[model samples]
Structures are given as C-alpha cells and as structure tokens.
Target: MVSDTEILAFFRGELSRQVNRKLQTVPLELETLLQDYAPADELPYVISDYSNKYGVDVSALDMRNYFPWENLPLTTRLFKGRNFRASVIANRKPLTVKMFAESARAGRWLYD
Candidate 1:
C-alpha cells in the first residue's frame, strides 16, 4: 500500500509540474482544492496523468462535479447570465489533494 506521504509527494511533484513551478517543500495541504493550484484547463490533464501513473480508475469521475468550467463560450455566457454561472461555481464540490491521494491508494475514484 502507498503511504499518505508518498501520495502527497506525487501530487506535489505533479502539481508543480502542471503549474510550471518548482516546489522545494509541500505546497499543498491535504484539504487544498487542486483548482487553486493549476488552471482548470490543465486540471483534467493532471488528473489523467495521476490516474494513469497510480492505476487509479477515474472513468466514473465527472469533472463538472468537482470544478467549474473555466471559460464559457460567448453564447453560453449570454444565455446563462452571471447568476447561472455563479450558481454553478458555488455548487461545485471541492476536489482536494487528499481525495486524490485516497483514490490513488484505493485504485479507483471514491467520491460521487
């Protein structure tokens, strides 16, 4: 079984790579939301890389359930309006480093 420390280290390295920043120390806490570290556009790629590297099955994971869309198209912005967009952001469940670590250890996505 992978220890939590190893899992966290993997995330630290992966996140640092995604953000193009070299971290000398733990830059992320277990509860830290991953969206805060990397761009939403890059988040899926990061997760995909992690899933592949750790053999974690993420087929059931939905990106929309965790992070809000980064950029809505012009038509979407106009039709959805600011309130609709705000609600989507407000209702998104946080995808934290701890969750990723847990999933990695479990070899599958654990959150709904």
Candidate 2:
C-alpha cells in the first residue's frame, strides 16, 4: 500500500519539477492546492500521470470541477463583468495533494 508520506513526496517532487520551483523544506500537506503548483492547462495531465503512476482510478474525476478554463478572451472577460468572473472563481473546487494521496491509498477517486 502507498503511504501518505510517499504520495506527498511524489507530488512535491513532480510539481516542483514541472513548475521549475524549489522544493519546500516542509512536506506538502493534504490541503495544499494542486493548482498553485502548476499552470491550469497542465493540471489535468499532472493528475492523470499521478493516477497512472500510482494505479489510482480517476474515471470519476472531472477536471473542470477543479480548474477553471484557461483564461477567457479579453472581450469575454470584459463583457462578463466582475460578477461573472467572481462566480467562476468561486465555483472552482480546489484540487489538493491530499485528495490524490487518499485516492491512491483507496485505489480509486474519492472526491467529487
């Protein structure tokens, strides 16, 4: 079975590498938002890779729920106004390193 520590280490290393960021001396926690570690466009692939590497089933995982679409066009943003933008941001459910770790331990996706 994969331990949470192992899962945290994997994410910390993988995300740090992908983002070209330095590793934190402290290990990433369950609440650590995955989006903060990588660009929105890259998050899906990162999650997919993690799922595959650890044999976690991710068929139920929806990327849209966790990530907003890569930036809207300027025209759309302007027309949408502050409320629309705020709603979109508010609706995003944070995908965290802990969720992945839990799913890995369970051998399936655990979050909606």
For model 1 the local lDDT of residue 44 reads 79
Q: Superposing all C-alpha atoms, what RMSD in Å does each candidate have to the true structure?
A: 4.0, 3.7
lDDT of each: 0.77, 0.76
Q: Model 2: which ten-residue window has the lowest total lDDT?
A: 17-26
User: How well does candidate 2 score on lDDT at residue 108?
Assistant: 97
Taking the tens digit of each residue's C-alpha lDDT, what string does model 2 give over 8-89?
A: 8877766644323464354457687776556676666777889889998999997777766445677877787888887887
Model 1: lDDT equals: 0.77
Tens digits of lDDT, candidate 1, 2-104: 7678777877776754333464453577787776666677777778888888899999888877765555577787788888888978888898888887888
| lDDT over C-alpha atoms for residue 18 of model 2 | 39
TM-score of candidate 1 on Cα atoms, chains taken together: 0.76
